[model samples]
Target: MRGTIVTLGGGGFSMADTGITPIDELLLGLTGKRRPRVCFVGTASGDAASYRERFFDAFGARAHASALVLFGQATHAFTAPQILLEQDLVYVGGGSTANLLALWRLHGVPALLEQAAAGGTVLAGISAGMNCWYEGSSTDSFAPLAPLRDGLGWLPGSACPHYFAEPGRAERFGEWVADGTLPPGYAADDGVALVWRDGALAEVVSERPGGQAFAVTAAGETPLEVRLLARF
Candidate 1:
């Protein structure tokens, strides 16, 4: 069976509104196997330690059947192919996207993730986690410090999280799109998520009332426009 991918905006844990229900539905849709195996990667924030607790708090007793695995260090060879082989979900955590990608690639985790996903492992991530799938991104959180780092490219374009919070971020995103430095993509606000399946956007969901998504593309030299996606 084909699996599902859930990418979250930054501040997933603190966000008052997290569209985790849709993610749950997607996971249930993927498999009916009891006690699904789940793995987490790249949490410099120390959030992975409480993943199961937080999930149970948010989802209640229904989360009991899920098994959570965490890979917290910056670079470590994930030696459990048995776990990878049997995992139903592989989740990446939020942190420095550059560092996460570097560590993941250095440890050859990305290729392993691809293999797992191709083999029907449900893939999900939040914040920097989500950013890992895109080719590149405009993130004040990490990009300014290390511009040369490449993302995992699980998807075909760029990803911009915290899309509306930062000043002039929209303008910067447009510039990158126009210059062909980044591909056409979606910008996600907190509490909102864009779901991509089989290399295509399947749907978007929002738990917060004010979040909006932007579709950006190059219009002309030194010009770009940000338009709201009607679907969201």
Candidate 2:
């Protein structure tokens, strides 16, 4: 089945309260479902309560929004298959990619996510969430920028978020891909997302002017052509 996946390097509504994020609006549009149900999976960051509150303040009024908290008392039902598969969009938050993966596997969240994706549910996220879909990614999960090759493999290659925002991200990501520490992949700056449709890249989109995405390889890094979407 054809499915859509949007992986953002950073910049979205996840931690914002000032205004609705354009990138988030783009993700919601991809669902193409009325009053789409958007669920935030916050296993990362230890399901911090502040994260949940910010999420609701930003997304709750616009759509049927809920968050899946894995630690402490569960706010929403822990039924991954029923809840995740039923939603039009599943947005994962950024934090501790390693821990996120571990907990997800422990709770069978990965399988349910795969099922949801196969069913045409839009899967999208920023940072750690973005990293989970590829074969691998560069992350700070270990408190250092390191290559982690244990992705869910929903998409090919690797991913690196905060390409420019982080001091060593672009350089380290390039070195890893070049030396075979990690495979060739995509890197994105804050406010940009790499859009995939049916396992192929359809486009790169950005919320802010000058936000960019790139294709990194042993050869060198080349900018991925991107469209700057206008926000009303």
Candidate 3:
């Protein structure tokens, strides 16, 4: 079983549009299914109703859009595995990365998602969602930007999202890698994504002009040329 992981530094269906952005359009196309059923897991935001609404509003017109709310109230009936594995795409919403990981473990979401990925579901997400796929990441989920060592490890190495959106992200991440706190990994600017097929980076896509991705290691950060796509 092979799979693809789309890691976004920022930007996606949640960005709000009468139509989807190019980056999101690319993600939908990866499913290889017409009108694919896409499930939004909003555990990071504590199952925020507004976030769920955003998902439906963005994707409902094009796909069978739905959400899995693990807090406050239940919105979907199927079990985690059922919902995860049966879908064409499973998108994770961003919020608190630490909390997201903790909650996911509590509900066995990690295992279910791994199963979904192994079965060839297109797994994608932004921010914390992006951070979760790597062995570790540089995140602000704990207040300040810090090294988050615990991750699902679906992709090799580490990751850092919002590489350019946040000030000092590049500097701090470099320092972490230099000091051996975080492993060398990839990073992306807002509105950009790193696409991995079978655990190897296959492409870089961006919705905004000048949006970028990078390969950051102990030596230094090197910019990855990305193909920019026009907005819908």
Candidate 4:
């Protein structure tokens, strides 16, 4: 089945107090449901209570929002995989990609996520969350913002989130792709979402002005057109 993935460099409810934004609005729209079942995967943030609160405050009033809290693997009626499968949309919160990867693997989440995507669940995230779907990405999970080459491989090539908002991200990602430490791939600036549909790039959208995107290769980097959301 055709599925969708929206990889945002940054922006969304995570950035604002009210958490309302065009990007998040678009996510809900993608689900094609009235008050779709939305799940917030905050594993990257260690299932922090504050982050969960923020997500609920932003989405609770609209969608059927819930946070799949995995901390300590607390006893619950449903397993992590089951909760993930039931969502119309899965929004991952940003945090340490390295830790997120490790924990997810331990809990058998990768396969379920793959299944969720194949089943037409709209998967989206920012920063570390965005980095999880690709084969590799530029990350701050380690010191010096290194290239993280081991990813889920759902999409081809590598990826780098927060390309403009963070210092040295562009430089390091460019270098890594050029030197073949990572494959030639895509990078998204703050407020930009590199959307992929059915395994190919569908469009590049931005929540604000001045946001850009790029296609990075060993030869060089090329600027990609970013469509500013009308509501923004």
Best by TM-score: 2
TM-score of each: 0.72, 0.95, 0.94, 0.94
lDDT of 3 by residue, 82-177 (tens): 578788899998888889999888888888888888888899999998999899999888788989999888898888988988998989999988
Candidate 1 — which residues are off by over 4 angstroms?
A: 1-3, 11-35, 44-60, 64-82, 141-149, 220-232
Tens digits of lDDT, candidate 1, 1-232? 1346767664444343543454444454455556565554544343344554455454343333332233533433334434555677765666677766666666666677778877888787776777788778766565462222277766767777776666666677777887777887667766566767777676776655555666666762221222222321
Task: Order the candidate numbers by TM-score, best to worst.
Answer: 2, 4, 3, 1
Q: lDDT order of candidates, best first? A: 2, 4, 3, 1
Cα lDDT of model 4 by residue, 80-175, tens digit: 556888899999999888888888898899888889888989999888899998999998888679888888888889999988788899998999
TM-score of 3: 0.94
What candidate 4 gets wrong by more than 4 Å, as runs, is: 73-79
Higher-lDDT candidate among 1 and 3? 3
Q: Rate the local accuracy (lDDT) of all candidates.
A: 0.59, 0.88, 0.86, 0.87
Candidate 4 TM-score, true structure as reference: 0.94
Q: Once all C-alphas are superposed, what RMSD does model 3 give against the true structure?
A: 1.9
Clashes of each: 0, 0, 0, 1
Q: Which pairs clash inside model 3?
A: none
- At residue 217, candidate 3 shows an lDDT of 91
Off by over 4 Å in 3: 17-19, 74-81
Q: What's the C-alpha lDDT at position 146 in model 4?
A: 86
lDDT of 1 at 110: 69
Query: Candidate 1's error at 165, in angstroms?
Result: 3.1
